[model samples]
Target chain A: MNESDLPSFLLDGEEIPFTPGQTVIQAALTAGHYIPHLCYHPEFVPHGSCKVCTVKANGRPAAACTLPAQAGLAVESDTDELNDLRRTLVQMLFAEGNHFCPSCEKSGNCMLQALGYDLGVMTAGFRHFFPDRPVDASHPDILLDFNRCIFCKLCVRASEEVDGKGVFSLTGRGIMRHLIVSAESGRLADTDIALTDKALEVCPVGVILRKHVGFAVPIGRRRYDERPISAQALDDAPRMMEPKHG
Target chain B: MAEGRIRVATASLAGCFGCHMSLLDIDERLFELLEKIEFDRTPLTDIKHCGPCDIGIIEGGCCNAENVEVLREFRRNCKILVALGACAVTGGLPAQRNHLDLGACLSEVYLTEPGLVNGQIPNDPELPLPLDQVHPLHEVVKVDYFVPGCPPSADAIWKILADLVAGRTPRLGHGQIQYD
Candidate 1:
């Protein structure tokens, strides 16, 4: 149907004309609602992981990242069920690995840290499993501790897609599964897999880092304090903090 | 043994001196630490490879046959063996080529060229044979305390060591990046 022949209706009791091929969250984003999320960068294809941005659409919790927008659909993007689901997901992430935020350099500025706070993940409901892990700090300018990784796969996808390096890959299985730096050495410096700014920028957490920059910007003026990494739907709006996180 | 001095044996299997360098980064506090730590066999102090100790600190990853032998000896002797640095921690940078065929790496980087090393690989009687893959110390021996940092920051190493001296289990990431 042509633009003139499209259906015009009320979305959340507000008058709006629907656009084609956008998700309910995307339309909501366009309509100025900042739904919280991680693992859903605008440039990449939808992954729908890190269920932090779940929202109730038509009375059921739906992942805002992958759900498609329909004509005049009522999406309860801010319902209690979705909040509960997000809280549960965050709690699970807390239980999975060694995420000790207080000692972490990214304490005040981490996105995962912020989401855990937003979801009220005070304690991990499940038993904590402190897996033995080796951190790769061989690279002159990057450090990696897989123990701190949440398996968001953003670095793996970014390195493969945006940077064309495909340097990072996830390996192993079950609780033993981990992100391997090259073959399985877990050393980033040894591999010919070069680093790019793209992979450095998209890492939701601090698994990857630019050396010599920790605590460089001080506490009060840190990125998380300035913006609080919740749902960023600013529509190509430039986030002005330091972006090297891969 | 006056009271509660933990006997820690420090040894290197197949890595550079960097891991030891990280340990020394603990600095002047070593004097205060000497009151608590009892070192029986260490590369810096003791020359003998064999030792009777409580906690064994093994630097370097196992690469050559000599390294493997040294690691096995330490694993056999010590009550708790701690893998230090990237080398011992996860095979470090040396294992980067485990993904590649040894023949291909040998020919590409060393041989198949007009340099001194040609298509034929080196055949030395003294040199130990290289393994098809590099493996972390944990893959071979059970590790009690896992300190995952390249060469862990001085504070990290200190915290773990201090906790050990205090008879408490050393833990990392108080909940920083942790999530399920």
Candidate 2:
């Protein structure tokens, strides 16, 4: 089929041209439209664990990051219903973990925090779970604050797929599922994980942080500090890049 | 109506009064604000108890019995109560102690810290007892509105107040609303 005959989908009333295998998120991003997402990094395979990118496709709720964009598909994102659902999902993430944003080093730069702001999640709507998670500062250069993990698994994917070092993995299921270091000693230092690894930069929250560099960028000048996540998403989207063919 | 101005009361509970500072950050706008509203039971007025007021803006979480009492009193006296910052809205920095044992926390602060000469956890009857967990103001009393920030920006506070003074519900949008 010719490139002109490629499938195009309507995302919130805008025509987004997509390759046969491109997901709604990929097409939307490529088309300069921003869909709020956490676990759908472009470099890694879409892991729809966080459900922040849920959109209504043909009147059915679907994960935009994982859903294939088909011709004539009507994907509704940024609606009141989808935003409310996204807010609830953000609230659930907040309640599930001890996401103390004010004290966190990753406060302004965190995608989760920025997304929460974007979705108008003003409060933790659910009761605080206040889970007793451990902070693994065992690594000499990295501080693994488990209390803020959203379980997006970007670090896991980046470590295993990109870095060629299977350093991180998620253990357990459902509410109990958590990120675990793949080392006999169960510490990041024991693993081949380095500060320069893609895994360190892949975390969307304050979970995997480099030690001694807390609050390096200051408050008002950090990423997402100047603009909302929606704007940031569009600005950060790859420019003029052709859609990847399967 | 006989009342010419909106009666406003504000208080700080377990907060650092940064929200009040942010309110002050309204700057020269306060002169304009005074034309529309009047301070009642606020730290600005040094009033101990709030009289019946048009709005009550509380700026911290309920970390002690006094905070709860003040929050409840604010609910009773004010027509509308607003949670004015992250603390009042979500327990903020004070709530960090929620993860640690309260006794251990107090002990660490008092007895176990380095360079402490004579350290004893104060148990004065006059002192308000800290709750086992720090709670957002809404957990204790109904909050009519919320202005969320570490301390909400001066623009945000001004917007909320200006909206309230104009008899409209305040809504924060992109630039106005910030979580950090």
Residue A136, model 2: Cα distance from true site in angstroms: 1.8
Error of 2 at B160 (Å): 1.2
Task: Write out the backbone clash pairs for model 2.
Answer: none
Predicted candidate 2 versus true structure: per-residue lDDT over A48-159, tens digit per residue: 8788899999999999999988999999998998888889988888878888778889988999888877877778766677778888988899999999998899999999
Report the Cα interface RMSD of each model, rounded to 1 decimal. 10.8, 1.4
Candidate 2, overall lDDT? 0.87
Strongest candidate by DockQ: 2
Model 1, residue A149: distance off in Å is 1.2
Candidate 2 segments whose C-alpha is farther than 4 A from its true place: A1-3, A240-242, B114-118
Q: For residues B15-127, could you state the per-residue lDDT of candidate 2 as single tens digits?
A: 99999999999999999999888999999989999999999999989999999999899999999999999888888888888888999999999999999989999999999
lDDT, candidates in the order shown:
0.66, 0.87
Residue-wise C-alpha lDDT for candidate 1, range B91-149, written one tens digit per residue: 65566555567678777766766665335676789878887666667666676655544
Q: Could you tell me how far off, in angstroms, the CA of residue A123 lies in candidate 2 after the best superposition?
A: 1.6
